[model samples]
Target: MKNTYIPITMEVEKNYFETSDRMIKTLRLKFLDERFDFEPGQFCEFSILGKGEAPFGIASSPFDKAGLEFSINRAGVVTKAIHELRIGEKVGIRGPLGNYYPVKEMEGYNVVVIGGGFAFTTLRSLIEYMLNPERRGKYKSIKVIYGARNPGLLLYKDLLENWEKRDDIGTYFTIDTKVEGWNKMVGFVPTITEEVAPSPENCYAIVCGPPIMIKFTLPVLLKLGFPKDKIVTSLERRMKCGIGKCGRCNLGEFYVCNDGPVFNFEQLEKLPKEV
Candidate 1:
C-alpha cells in the first residue's frame, strides 16, 4: 500500500549559520515542488546517479511547503556528493519515505528532544513543526537538549537562539569542550540530561544522535520513568534504496525504510543494537 521513490528537483541552498571547527552545517539542498508530504522525522533517498544514493532526514518542517531542505554534515562519500551539489543542480531524489514522528499522539504531554551532533538535522524538523500554531497546542511542553564536540560543532545556532527565547519551549545546549564564550552545561548529553531530570509522567521523549549517545540516554530515560513505548527514536543505518526493497537497512524481520526510521524503544529492542 506504500510507494517508494519520487522525482524531485533542486530549489535552493543556504549558508551555515556560523563557522564550526570539526563540523559544518550546510542548509544544503532545497527540492522544488516536491509535494513530498513528510511529517517530522521522516527521510528521503537522494542520489547523484553513479555516485550512489543515501537516505537523509527531511530537515525542513512540514510547515514549509515551498520546498524541502536537508541540513547535512560533510561525513561520508554520499554526503560529500550531496554537499557538492551546486544550486540549480538536479540530483535524483526518491521519497518523503520513512515513518514520521508522532506529533498528534503527543498532545497534552511534555515532550523532550535529545539530539547529538548531526542528529539535530532530523530533530530540527520536529521542533519547527511543533512550533507552528497549526500544531503548537498539541504538546504541553517542549525541551531540546543538544550537544556536539564544541560550540562550533553545534548546528542551528540561530534556531537555538530563537528556541531559547520562546516561553513555551525549554531549550538547553552543551558542548564537549568549553569555547571562549560558552557557559552552559559541560559534559555528554546523557549526563546533562540526567542533571535536568525531566519528568517522564505523561511525557514523550524523541531521541536521535550517534549510537553511543542513544545508548547512554536510554537507560537514563528508563530510570526517569519513561515507558518503552513513550520513548521513540530514528535509527540510521546503511542504505541505498529509500524503500524496503533494498534489504540493506533491515533488522531481523523489520526494515528501517519500511517499519521505521522512527520507532519506539519496545520495537527497537527487537532489532540489533545500533551501537
Candidate 2:
C-alpha cells in the first residue's frame, strides 16, 4: 500500500478564543495545488513536528474555501502546546481523512441536528452546509438543538445568535443551569430534545456530544419514532493514525478512523457497546 501522507505545510491564518481555555484556529492548506477539499464530518491529522499529531474534525463547511478550522480544548499536553502557537506559525496537515456524513442521501428529508459542548464542531459544518444558499433547498426543514454547560462555554456564539434569528431554520439553544438575564431554554440537552419532540416523520437526526448526553438522547430519539438507521452520530476516539492500521480506535473490529467517525445508529447497534 502507498503511504497516505501529505507533506502539506499550512499556516495558522487566524485564531479566536472560544473560551478562556479553548481556542479555534483556521489553517490554510494546499492540496492538489489548490485549497484542501473535504466533506463535513471528516477529520485531518494535525502535526506540529516535535509536539505530536492529533485528529480533529473539519469544523468548516466543505463549501467554505477560506481555510480549515479546528476546535481545540486546553486539556492535554499536545493541545496545550497547540494552544500556545501564534498566527502565521506553520503546521502539518495529513488528511481530509475518514468517512463523511451522508449529506447527499439526506436530500428531501428534514434534518434534526442535536449537539452539546465542544463536540458540536462537525455538526457546525453540517449545519452550514445545509444552510448554504446553493444547497439549502435540497432538504425540507432543519431543526437545531444545541447546549453547553453554561452560556460562557458555548462555542460559535456569534453564529448561533444569527441562526436563531433566521426563519429558514428552527434553532434551539440551552444552557445546563439558569443564570441572571438568560432567556433561552435552560436544561439538559436530552430533556429539551424530548420536550421539543421534533417529529421523526421523513426526518434524519444527527447527534454528537459527551457520552452521557448521547446515552440519554438516543432513547428519546427512538421513543419519538426515529429509526436507528435514520439517526447518526460521530464517535470521539483517540485515533493516533488517521488510517485503521493503528489498532487503537477500534469498536468491535471496526476502526473508527477507517470505518467511521460518522455512523448511523443502526451501524452502531451492530458494534460493541464500548465505542
Q: Which candidate is the best by lDDT?
A: 2
Error of 1 at 266 (Å): 0.9
Q: Write the per-residue lDDT of candidate 1 for residues 1-275, one digit (tens) a residue.
A: 33455546664466453345634546456656545577898887777767877778888888887677777767787777766666666776677788889887898899999999878777999999999998888888899999988877777788898888889999889888677889887889999899989999899999999988999999999999999999999978777676778798888778878888899999878776542
- Please list all clashing residue pairs in model 2, or write none if there are none: none
Superposed on all Cα atoms, the candidates' RMSDs to the truth, in angstroms, are 2.1, 2.0
Report the C-alpha displacement of residue 210, candidate 1, in angstroms: 0.7
Candidate with the greatest TM-score versus the true structure: 2
lDDT at 80, model 2: 74
TM per prediction: 0.92, 0.94
Clashing pairs in 1: none
Error of 1 at 265 (Å): 0.7
